[model samples]
Target: MNTNTACELKWGMLCAALIFLLLGACSDKDAIDTRPSYDPSKPVTISRFAPDSGGVNTQMIIYGSNFGSDTSQIKVYINGHLARLIGVNGTALYVLVPSKAGTGEVKVVIGNPAKEVVAAGPFKYIFLPSVSTLAGFTDKDGRTAIVDGPIEKAQFEEPYWLCFDEKKNIYVLEEFRGMRFIDADKTQVSTRFRTGNGLDRPRTLSFNTTYDTLYITNDQGSWTGLSTAVATKADNFTRWTSLIYSLQTNGGAAQPQTGDYFYNSYSNGAIFKWDRVAKVSKELFRIGDVSWEFNIQFAPSGDFAYIVVVNQHYILKANFNRETRQLETPVHFVGGRRSAGYQDGVGIDARFDQPHQGAFDENDNFYVCDIFNHCIRKITPEGVVSTFAGRPRTYGYADGALRDAQFDRPMGIIYDKESGTFYVADQKNRRIRIISTE
Candidate 1:
C-alpha cells in the first residue's frame, strides 16, 4: 500500500467525482429547458391598429416577442383562436389579429411548433363592434347596406357584407378571413363560419336578400403564393378553389362551393350564385383570375353589379338582364404598370399592371384601386374611366387625398354612400384613405 496503490486509489476517486458532477450538470440543464418561460420584456407593441385607422389584415405594425428568431409560420393565437401571425423577427412579429371583438379580450399565443405558448396576453385595445344585416343585402336606395356588413361607407378590412336572422344577430363576411357576427348593439358576433379552412385564394361574400342565404367564393390564386411577395394567402387554402357556404340559422342546409361555378375555375372564371331558398346554384358570372373581386357589391338597383380584378386586370360590370355574361367586359375602370419596364402596347387596358380592388361611388360609378400605379380610377357603368384617387409615383400623395405614395397591394375597398366617402385598402402603404368625391 505504498506510493503506487495510494495514488491509484486517489485518482479513481477523483474520476468518480468528475463523473457525478457532469451528470448533475446535464440534469440541471434539462430541467431548466423544460421550465416555463412565459415572460417577455415587451410582449407586443402595436401602433397601427389604433381606432379610426383603415382596415388591417396581417400587415400590423406590431412589436413583441418570446419569438427567438426566424418567424416563417408564426401562428398567433387570440385567446386560443388562430389569428394570423404573418412576418416575424427575433423580437417583433407583424401579425394579423382579427378585427376587434365587441367585448372579448385579445391574447397573443405564438405557435410555430408544438412548443408551449412562449407568451400570451391581451393586445392593444380593439373596439370594433359587429354590424348585423336584417336582410342579407340591404339596398334601400343609393344607400346600399349589409345588415351585418358595410354600409357603402365602411373602410378597408371593415366587414364588407353582414347578414342577420329573425333573432336579430348579425354576421360579417371577411375577404380571406372568415365570418363573424354582432348582437343588437353591434358587439362582436360569433358563429361557426371559418376563414381559411379551404380557400385557394382570396374570397368574397355574396348574399341573396330574396332567399336569406350567403354565397362564399375563394379564388385559389393567392394561396398558390405564386404572386408577388406581398400577396396575402390564406392558411385554409392549401388547394381550395372555391367554397359555397350557407348561413341558415336554427337548423338550415349546409352549402359547400360546388356546381359549375361553386368552385370551378372554368367558363370565364366567375363566381356562381347560390339560391339559399331553393338550395340550388348557378354560375352568376365570371370575374376572371384576378384577386380584385374580393370585395363585391350589388348596385342599389339590384340589377347591376361591378367587381374589381387585381393588377390592371379589370373592374368589370354585369348586366343581369343581358344573356351573355362575361367579365362584364372591363372598360379599363383603372389600368397602369406597377412593375419595372411593364408595358401594355396599343391599348389603354394593356397598361393596367396591378389593380388590386375597388368599390362603387354613390352615382353608381366605380372606384378602382390601381396598386403600384399610385392611383385609383373612377369608372362609369359604360366603361368610361378616370383617376379617382392618388397620383403617379412609388408612394402616397397629399395627406388627406390618395396622392402618390408607396403601396404594396391595396386589397379591400370600403365605401360609405351617405357621406360619399371612400376608403381604399392601401395594403402596402398599410393605411386607409378617407376620400370624398365632388
Candidate 2:
C-alpha cells in the first residue's frame, strides 16, 4: 500500500485499458466505403466518353453519374446496336462496341425500372468490314433453280461471275442458266438471259468502261470454237454476239483500260489482247499448260496485273507498262504453284486452294475468291496474304460478321470503289454475298 506501488498499479491499469480500446477498434469488421452510393430514384446521366470514335470491339470508357456498380442492370447501345457491358463502377462504365455499330448516338439504360440516358453528342462509331448474303438460299439442301424476282424469292444455280454495269446494275452468269440481273437497289433479281444458242455454260463476264457492252466467256470445249461472246445493253442483254470462234478454251476476260479487252485461254494458258472494234486478238503472255484456268485482273492504277491460275493455286504478278500498254512477263507473286492448302503468309509463303477470280480495291489491295478453300483472301500491296472473310476449308451458307461468315466455293469477287464494297459470287452455294463497311 505504498505511494509508489499505488502509482505503478494505476499506470498499468490505464495502459491495459488503452490497449483493449485499440484492439476493439482494429477488430471491427465493417470498413468505411468511399464509393458514392447508387440511388434508384436518381436519374442516370452520360456526360461523355473517351475516344468518341472507334470500330467494333473497341473498349470504350463512358463517364457519367448515378450509374450503379451492377453491370447486369446496365445496357449500352451505339447506333441502336447493343454493346457489351464489361464493367461498371457507380461513376464510370466500360463497354465494347458491337459489330455494325455505325456512326450514331450513344445510349445508356440503367436500374431495374430502367432510367435511360443519352449522350449529348454522337459516339461517332467506326464501321468494321462485315460479310452478309446479298442474295441466295442459305440452306444446304442442294436445291437450286433459276427462279428470279425479289431478293428473298430469287434463286440461283451455280452463279459464277459478277459484273457491274455503268448504272450499278449487276450481271451474274450462272453455269447452266444464262444471265441474272440485280437492280442497284438490291431489292430485285430478274432473268436477263437464259442458257441457249450463243451463250451456253457461261464461265465469266466483264463490263466495258462505258458498261454498254458485256463480255462473257463460255465453258464449251476448245474444239467448239464458240467460247467468246458479247452482249450489249442496246440488245437488252438478251442475245450474245460471237466475238470469235477459235480452238482456244476461253476462261475469263478483263478490260484493263478504256479500249483494251484482254482474255485468257485455258487450253494454252495464254492471255490474248482483243481489239473489240476489229475483233483481232494478239498474244500477251502464256504462263501455264492446258490444265490451268486463269482469271485476269488489273490494279486500280493499271500498273499491275494479277493472274489467278485457278487449278494451279497460285497468283502471278505482272507489271503493266503504262507507255507500251503491255504486261511484262509475270513473276510468282503469292501462293505456291501445285502446292495447295490453307495458309496465310507473305509472297510465295502463302498457299491457296483453287484461287479463282479477284479484284483490286481503291487501296490497291487485291482480294481473291479462294474457291476450294471456301474463303475470301486479301493480298496487300507488299504481298501479304490473309483471310479477309470466311473460314478456310469450312464451307456452308452463313451470313454475319466477316470472320464469322461462311461461304462455299466462292468463284469470283469484284470491288466497288465508290461504296467500299465487295461482291462475291458464292458458286456452289448459289448466292451472291457482299462485304461492306456499313
Q: For each candidate in the order shown, give its overall lDDT on alpha carbons.
A: 0.40, 0.79
Cand. 2 Cα-lDDT: 0.79
TM-score of 2: 0.71
Cα lDDT of model 1 by residue, 1-438, tens digit = 899997687556544544533343243544554322323443533322212122223233334445543344345554454555544444444455454322223444444333434332344424321121112221234132222233233322333333333343444445455554445443333433444544323344433343234444444343332110111124211122332332110001112112111222322444544453674545544444432232334565545555444432544444444343222432333333232222333324435545544566667766665556666656666566655555544453234433433333444455655334455444434333445432
- Displacement of residue 158 (Cα, Å) in model 1 is 12
lDDT of 2 by residue, 268-330 (tens): 788877776676888887898775777777776767778888888899988877676667789
Stretch of 10 with least lDDT, candidate 1: 247-256
**Window of ten residues with lowest summed lDDT in model 2:** 19-28
Q: List the residue pairs that clash in candidate 2.
A: none
Give me the runs in candidate 1 sitting further than 4 Å from their true place.
1-196, 199-202, 210-214, 220-271, 284-297, 322-350, 396-398, 402-408
